[model samples]
Target: MYRREYKVSISNYPYCNKKVDVKKLEEELEQDSNEQKEAVVYIHIPFCAEICDFCIYCHEQVVNNDKIEKYTNALIREIQEYSRKSYVRSLSIKAIYFGGGTPSMLSVNQFDRILSVCKECLNLVSDVEISVEVNVLNATEKKIEQFKYSRVKRISVGIQTFSEKTRETLGLPLKQKDLLNFINMMGQYEFPVMAIDVMYGEPCQEKEEIIQDIEIASDLNISHISLYQLCVIRGTKLFSRMQQFDWVQPDESMLYAMFNVADDTLQKLGFYNTVIPEYSKYGKESVFWKDNFNPQLDRLSFGASAYGYLNGRTYQNVCNVDTYINYLQKFKVPLDSISEKVTVLQKLERDIILQSRTQVIDTKYLEDEYNELYEQMYKETLQEIIDQQLAYREKNLIKFTKPGMYMQEDIAVKFMKSILEGKSRLYKKMVIGNQKI
Candidate 1:
């Protein structure tokens, strides 16, 4: 299962004795992977019309068609290579999520061919959830019309915020009229799930604006909403501006108010939090989120800077676009690194920590199966959090209190130990900072 991290450039062609090094991960997956045959596929489209100021995702501004054309070819080739694997071929796909930069940047024919190739080589369920993320700036009726006829069942729009002042502060190129028109135009189609992402707690944001955004989205007949708190990481334009202007963000109390307001509003609007930040009407839970993080399922990632957990291995692709294209074109695996998550303790940690975030941790099940491991790994920390009134246990599950939700990052970090591998191996830090949701 040894593989290059895509930053490695050693060979030209004949990249693998078996023809593709990326397949090595799959080949090894065939041998020792879990018995679950269902998988979720995530395809990353890393080109944006323009980069938002308050962002740090791996993306490049769309300058020309040449780069996109080359990247599409390489992406298709990467899919084909993975398709050839016995392990990949054996799985039944539960969902196919096309995330971005902005998946709408892809033309109809291009995405059509990509989906066609997937159909040609993979086993998709009769009612598989196929989702594509779009930017409001380019969520044209024509583009959405293409999706209506295609296999795409769920469409998520990255609207982030609808306030004109906040938009300007974030340097977002959005016009209110265009957004309204886009919404009206898109409303003509009856997609199963229509989602909008809303971010709050940004610098100079008002609580009422957050509530208004959610109210407007609900009024638009949108079926789903994802609420994310803005986090300005270093290297993003927002962080630079913050440093220059000493811009202050909303305090913890204000953020807490925003969360409660948004949460209460969505509930009153006939929506429930299917997961943290993701509110949905009945029967609209995102299949991608459900299956992608499921311990019983595999998540296979494609394209640049994608993170995946496949066959108990957590791997991330290199973020650089040219490096990704070159590695795949050269028949090499585009993995930045492949770390093992095959151990029992690692498996428990992955499942419990992720589960405890939005839902409850099934302590009864763990106590039944891994009593010793459970006591050693999480018992102390779990009890401490409960004593601290951050979390409480039900009959079998652990649920976070209101105070706990905001401090989940701290609680989760306490779960980390000087066990298998501190910062590497199976101990990779995932969302261990301030609660990402």
Candidate 2:
């Protein structure tokens, strides 16, 4: 039993802003490049036909073709500029992902040209896993054909729900019939994976509606199903509507019910839960996602509002489309922020926090690799979770149980909070003891 009251919010999460040092970033990228480490690349397509009120990511509604062409040219120039850098040229890119408002919005020619430019400039591996995000409305036959021709390994389709009520509530354009047709067409394709992205916890969503969405996805020959719980971002239009309508998040009890139902349903449908909210039928998780989240491999990001991590520094590109394009034209990195060099202690904490979210933290691995940063308080925190029966340890591995998964975010946060408090107290004691001496 834990006695403290704590809440997990997007702001308090560790991924928030940190310090930044541009020179250190340059040095780290250079060193990694020299070592010839495997890297991932992410390209952001910020142009969406219609803006979703619930979306928190940076995106602009497309108004003209000229702007798109200008952005595409700028993106190619940026990639070429990176190739000139010693570090970038040295990296063997393992994965490339095109994600955003809707990567499939681009014409086949545009997609091919961008891919060609990347291949010309970067040291892309032979079996690189290229993935593209597709809006259900945008997943035309021609686009699917383009993906096949481009050797794309996976396609992530955004079909948040199958319920007309929920879809209407979320202001989604198409109806259930449109998604059914899209699925039928996708079944004809030979893509390695076609993952469906679904969401739960909408104000108008019924339990049956969510279950129906999963059932529909399971019936299709889709390779994976990604089910996300809706988060009401603070500044988004959805959040404002919540206040006006007196809407609240589904209570914890209801949320847990939804999660368990989806987990159980997907598991029965032959989908392996690779990570919470992500299930794969073939048991192959996205290399880019794993690389990016694990924060060990270097990943480069291009285009507006794209975020990437390299050499322990996380960075985001400028969100404004015109500004990002202009800066690239001037031969500048369109970075909105480059986080400071992460301290070893922060790195250790991050590993524990992130691993705890979806998988076990291999205690033995941590001790062997990061013993210096693995302090007594950290170990004690791990012990507290075991003692509280929130997590179990076997040999060298520590993992949360099924019931514990629902509370995983809070568990990790509380443990981290306790470790930080202990550090504060110890520092205070050292100061007092020094005065006495």
Candidate 3:
């Protein structure tokens, strides 16, 4: 099985014609002295009982209880150190997402302690959405109860596929029975939101298997469904075994077919809001999907390998757990990488990209705000995409046609290329210095 990779050219597109003065924009934003913005915090708990072959997140396989304890303590120390330096004042936490390597692997008591620390460090809203990512292997009735008590209103469970063969290939823990039981338990708790993460295009997955997984998820009445396409990230076990496993990813035609099937099925079942490439649901109440396109809400991240966007800059913590812990021990911020401060123009572009992912972008507003960029880079490409039925354009809004949503990343790159090629003066050393974990 061979997977075909598609390349989209940005040079010839109508939207790729613009030149942006990156340096000028950056200086203007800095001179304005804008107040810092409130942000959502993402805490990455990178410990798992077993390493899934397809997982690329920074996580270590926990060998014993001692390692878990140490990791929890390190996380607390890191949080305290960051709070003191950042002086988290009245800035309310919009969302606190505990992601990666199975945060549910921590004991109930450990989770409580961590949540307690978070509350003390930041100003939290009454309806602040707190989410934890859990693997089915670690998710249990007891764990769900603990999460609810901890004020965690949302749960995202990893149930990549219902097929046993695919599970083996992905090296995921939990049997079909275990997964079903977990879903039933979650229903009992009726957590405000219950999301399941499923993967398509795995080595052992077929079109029919994908359909079956969606049907099962819908039957369970989960609040949201994140249907991800499998990608073999560099350095992952799956990437190494790609050849041996005869893994086959869907071709363009097959991918298009898969998307249609999912879109139709999920929508018919009332999961109409397409949150991202891999996510959709039936409601407006979810924090995960709420105001995702808003430019005002900044994203804050913690733990190894997590990234945060705050004020006008983006920062990433050290990716190595040991190094991150060591820095915390010395009472230092453990950030290892940072991107150039985000400019107002860049933020506008980000807002456009995020909105475009939902298959709807207000072209008029974008054109009015980024008139120069529209003339330079997006005009031809936008028309071309619309002509191809990949996107639909009205007076001021250009939205992805169903097919365009699957290739949103490619579209983004095309837009970014125009900026990258024309703006040599925009490039600068990152404020946090370049460090790879």
Model 1 agreement with the true structure over 199-314: per-residue lDDT tens digits: 99889998899889999998888898988878777788998998898988887778788887888888898998765557898888898876654666777889998867666566
lDDT of 3 at 219: 88
Which is the winner by lDDT between candidate 2 and candidate 3? 2
lDDT of 3 by residue, 1-437 (tens): 11233222111111211133223322332343235556677788999878888876688998787877877888898777556533344356788889888899989988888889989987777788899998777766788899988878888888888888888878776788888887887888878878888777777567887778888998887868876777676678887787776776667677667767877777777776555544555443456444434556666567887765555555567788888877777876766655455555565566666666567777777678778876666678678768877788665678777777676655654454424444442241111012211
Q: What lDDT tens digits, residue by residue, belong to model 2 across residues 140-177? A: 79888888888899888889898888887777788899
lDDT of 3 at 89: 47
Stronger candidate by lDDT (1 vs 2):
1
Query: What is the lDDT of every predicted structure here?
Result: 0.75, 0.74, 0.68
Predict model 1's lDDT versus the native: 0.75
Instruction: Give the C-alpha miss distance for residue 340 in model 2, angstroms.
Output: 2.0
Candidate 2: list runs displaced more than 4 Å: 1-24, 27-33, 411-437
Candidate 1 Cα outliers beyond 4 Å, as residue runs: 1-27, 30-36, 418-437
Task: Give the candidates in order of TM-score, highest first.
Answer: 1, 2, 3
lDDT of model 1, residue 220: 89
